[model samples]
Target: MDDRIIASLETAVGATPDDAVLRVHLAELLLAAGRREEAVRHAATALAADPTSGPARAVLADALDEGAPAPQAPAEDAAGTGEGFDWSRAEQEVGDLAPPMYADGAQDPQGRAFDVEHGDVRLSDVGGLEKVKERLEASFLAPLRNPELRRLYGKSLRGGLLLYGPPGCGKTFLAKAVAGELGAAFLHVALADVLDMYVGSSERNVAELFRVARESGPCVLFLDELDALGQKRSLTRNSGMRTTVNQLLTELDGIGRDNEGVYVLAATNHPWDVDPALRRPGRLDRTLLVLPPDRPAREAILRTHLRGRPIEGIDLPALAKRTDGLSGADLAHLCESAAEVALMDSVRSGTPRMIGMPDFAAALEEVRPSIEPWLETARNVALFANNDGQYDELARYLRKRGRR
Candidate 1:
């Protein structure tokens, strides 16, 4: 069957080297077959064939990201901001850990998102959320940013932080900004990309990814949707997921060596579902609740989307004030809705016109905050699952918002 699949892909590639989709499929197949080098080659070819292709980029990123032991660059990059780390021996370590099922069953880990790139948007780039910023500054950033003070206090940088909140509220965005603030390479690992594979293979993948992260020092490994991987052991029936969680615990504890420069950050919408083991100190112990965007944040998002677009009489302050409870995405949709209204109106009148407050007003009615349901659900979790007061921050936010 492997031979057949390879033969078919080879024939297809021969028939059409210009077909980017076929090349991407061939790349994914090669990757699933454990031919990392070939997979990367095909993915690069596909990307060159179609520079605008998203799948080609994805395949290429996944190949570069997971293959590990990529060739090292000069100590300093063109930006001269940070030096690259050597990932020279990653492939050797992973080869031993990789299970036989991959070659036998053909379970592909690509096609899922795994991105590692540099970030430039700093914490200041984030709109508002003063309290959130303050908490992060005190807990996550202070140690790295203030090395002298950190040494005076004997603070260690090896630890994990878990950010929990409703979806579309910028948990991932904040993670990237945190990386940007540190000027570190950001590796975004969607947990679903790692967890649902064969037995022992999932654990190997988790271990290998962390190995890559450790080698790539000053790297911010942002694991989004962590609950799926760390779901409560009692509630979960899968032994494979449980092993993955244990592997995560081991990696966090820095079992063999120091985790000095590799900062681990994870975000999940359902913190309650995450395994309690993962929350123990020296792991993902510290928790921060990322709530809906405040008025200032909404305004920032609106302005960002509206910039360079023709508009008039758009009272940003008024709209921001009225848009209480809207998430960043919700605010973006509101802006899009208003722009769509103006575009349609211009078409009907056969005269171009700028978007106005009325269109924004109509958008307000159409796009109510999608966070209310999340808030309601959060209220229950905060109130009932206030076990040991972990959800105290959430409870306080709910009470302050008068939604409790």
Candidate 2:
């Protein structure tokens, strides 16, 4: 089958000598067939015709990754008659064959749909974080669903949200839920995406990201562990980090006023580590701290996670009481740990059935809250949080706890 695909690709390339699109397609097919060396040659040919062909460049990069040799022009045949190909005509034909460029002047071959990935934790899948959900609904969902309300109020909804909390407390999960709720194109911008070792590349990538978001309107750009990109300049020796942050700040500022449809959502465990400028009024204005689940929330989380399992003898309320100071994620982990115990029991006792209370009780020894480190950061955030400031909600939560 691979040989057939490669043969067809070769035939297509030969027939469409000047067609860059065909060449690129052939390159993709070759790459898929593990013919990296051949793919590189085709990609190089396509790029030679259309210098701005991103797909060809991407294919070339993949080929290079597989140690493919550089492409060279073929020598004359035994006929000894040098049939000089019209390079300019080939270039024009390839250029014409290429797909329409994005409004941001970038070639996105996979299109907007390419941004969506397979694995995603939906809002319904999340066990707890009721307050977090309500806040997101009010801030994000409400604004998106009722655009007219925002227009009447003369407020342009912009400047993405920042979710800061302990690890395993559902910050990332909440970000995913927001994307799912909005039904918008979700782009997870990794720290590496915006951070480059090259001098201006980091800044350029940041600008390109916002540009992509604008072109793909009603999109959500979720920057996870945003502190890596938005860290305080003083804390880093890498000049690239500083440049990236500056670029992000500029993009975010413009996005607030210009991007009527694009939404930016970022998550970080160490909010204090983030640059102060980013947390100010214009960048990530609305910050939400996802705390560990309370007793009621924990019980609800357990029940949600254990919905399909046969737990006839289990008492969720009692388990919730035992699991105090645990986050929603922690509860989920607990359920998983219990399931592991049940599996072990099934293997030992030959009864592959329900997970009893003993399984849960034993799992408790292994599952623990991941919120301790964030507690210190939350304390610092609380100190900076003024009554009238944007972090008032976070401040209130910390103050109520009183321990720090």
- How do the predictions measure up, each by TM-score? 0.71, 0.65
RMSD of each: 18.7, 15.6
Q: How many angstroms is residue 392 displaced in model 1 relative to the true structure, after the best TM-score fit?
A: 1.5
- lDDT scores of the candidates, listed in order: 0.84, 0.79
**Candidate 1, residues 137-215: lDDT per residue as tens digits?**
9999988899999999999676689999988889988999999999888888886668756679888878777776766
Give me the displacement of residue 104 in model 1, in angstroms: 18
Candidate 2 — which residues are off by over 4 angstroms?
Answer: 1-114, 117-128, 255-258, 307-311, 351-353, 380-392, 402-404
Residue 322, candidate 2: C-alpha displacement in angstroms? 2.5
